[model samples]
Target: MVPSSHFNHIRDNTDLKLELKIPELNSQFARNSHNIPPYAQNKPPKPPNLALKISMAAKTTEAPSLSFPRDIFAALSPSPFLLAHLSPQTPSTPSIRPNGRAPSEFRKPTIHRGSLTHCSGSAVVRLGDTAVVCGVRGEILLAADIPNPPSAPPQPAATDASDADADDEDDSAELSQLSLLVPNIELATGSTPTHLPGSPPSTLAQSLTARLRALLLSTRLIRARDLRILHRAPPPPDAAATPDVPPTEEAKAYWTLYIDTLFISLDGNAFDAAWAAVVVALRDTRLPRAWWDDDVEAILCSDVPAEARALRLRGLPVAASFAVFAPGGGVGDSAFRDGQEERAWVLSDPDAFEEALCPEVVTVTVDCTGGERRVRRIEKSGGSTVGRELMKGVVQRAEERWKDWLEVFGVGNS
Candidate 1:
């Protein structure tokens, strides 16, 4: 039932400009951007490890309701849900996961290893309703030098394509770092039972690739200086080597390690699911030692390689998405909820059905890198407005879940 005084959306034909006069509602709609893509030029310059998806929906009630933050590009889409005030019904506390599981019943994940034999390391993981798979593959290439190499050089990793555009001659022979490729494929078939025609790859794959690559470089996980050629430098090779390098300015190594991962299948919680496989596969990686020669213009490697390194990931970014339905009278307080530490119905992960019903979706991405497994990046993604009360609940609960992960990872709780 649409409201009698339905909001007459006023958009500028030239640029799709929206103008709302309601003071309070105006404030809610005043977000910086509608929905910015990951590598958005004006976006915050940070590489995010996890991709969050949020969904929003409006109740059928005519009380004036419309979903805010629509038309998501790639990376994170809002997960949707429905909740009505029907005279304000405080839902009788339901079973923990609404699946009748005890409050402590965490989603059980099925782990499959060697899923992608063609790739370096691969695994298919399923977390109850959500499923995700990751693979790692890389070619030994010369490292790329940043336009302006840091005194501590940056890894010359390429993001766009394998046709990495780089300059190999200007590199110093002392550094040894290999560019790695971590591609993620989000399979449409993994979502529901609707038989997504298993085609020749899809949009999810491309977006995942962009998102993963951006996340890798943005974080500066691996740097070029860290890319040292063991045999290329010592008692032999000159100071000038032209090893084929990737355009990666970030090279990842041990101590503060980096793992190149790819996503294959995606069900729901791809972030958490992929992480499980990533950590395990990384534990399995064994890199080779090789160096560059500046003078002779060559990279050297030990007949029997010496040292191999792998960085211990700060931990994984467990992302959560939830949807809110029929929010804010659709007229009065028509603010959409879209913030990391704000909003409610924040699920560990959401399934497709739930996604369809939401008017506003929220995703919170957290990183638990502490030896004790801490939390980082409480990233919000709905790109909408939700009342302050609901927003608080979302943040509070997300923290709880973060702690739960630590318990499981630290205690080895099966």
Candidate 2:
């Protein structure tokens, strides 16, 4: 069973105080303590140079050429992603709260491993509101199929073009086939406060999938060569000369491993949660060996074990999201951390509800590799802003958020 998740924040008032006030935390780092720097000699004779302070204030009093959003969906607008999902009060569409933050941070996460006890390895992973499960089974890959024996190969030279065309058509038909029978998502009947029946993949889901796929593929987490298995179509019992063994049905036949993901909970950024869950489960996966001995020959199914290989990945992709605050609420300096009031959720994480209330938003994907990290892409959303400086803070905060996630995951600084 996976960890059932609920979205929450460091909501306790004391936590908020600690988060908001640190540098001035005279108690946490008292000067009199032995931990103090050696420069402090117990002597007290230093006084501020009032003349120098005045000169600096006079030189730099202009309210920093503030940079903020200019349009509804531009660098100054609120989070476009937030406006896409619905709230508990309104299931039909998403709504923003005045104070921001839905009082929850992340939905519950559920992880089930080895769902198919009969199969070599399998897993069903659900991440708080966003769910996904994947299974791995053993199978002997059969050699490439051979074309039916030709009766009489002599086609006229005049029909050469027709033969070429026939081959092209067959290849094209095979290429267009879509057989991804695995349901990529599953929802806990209770993800949302209400049920959204008959709803196809929502725009948010589709967008998230694209981003997730991009991240997974770009990183090369699982190589195609590694996943390949020798697939064999056993001869059927109907044939007297060759033993005939009927192939299994879609659900039963053919080793089909599934990763069922349900979005019982809907937050602004379900993609990140889903990706994290998948990564964790994959790291924990192991395939058992399958050996078969017939009347004549012995067959061995290849098993992908951690001891034999390391999961090859291009790199880890991290997403950083931001929210815009209205004029009445609080806005922080994303660029400079020296401001006392800037501690408002700008340079840190924000829950789903907090995101909706903000007007302008930005999301960034970062890749950590080669002893360094770099920005892969920057998605700028539209929304109007109260001032120009707010936009600047958004960009700065986006970078900081990326750094924070890296540190949290112990992936190292970008």
Q: What do the candidate models score in CA lDDT, each in turn?
A: 0.45, 0.45
lDDT of 1 by residue, 223-249 (tens): 333343322223224324635533333
* Regions of candidate 1 where Cα sits further than 4 Å from its true position: 1-106, 110-119, 143-181, 186-201, 218-266, 292-307, 325-344, 368-375, 378-392, 407-414
**TM-score (C-alpha) between model 1 and the true structure:** 0.50
| C-alpha-based local distance difference test score of model 1 | 0.45
* RMSD value for candidate 1: 28.8
- Give per-residue CA lDDT, model 2, range 1-414, as digits (tens): 544342224346667788779857766667657776656656775766999889888889867675544344333434332332222346664343333434223233455655655534445544333445444333443222213311222222224575344422322111112111122544445565444666676666566656655555444454332332322334466667644533321111112223334464655456555665455445444534433334434445455654333333335565656555433342332333343233223322344545555545566666655545566666556554424575455545445554544554454442
Supply the TM-score for candidate 2: 0.42
Q: TM-score for every candidate vs. truth?
A: 0.50, 0.42
Which RMSD does model 2 reach against the true structure?
27.2
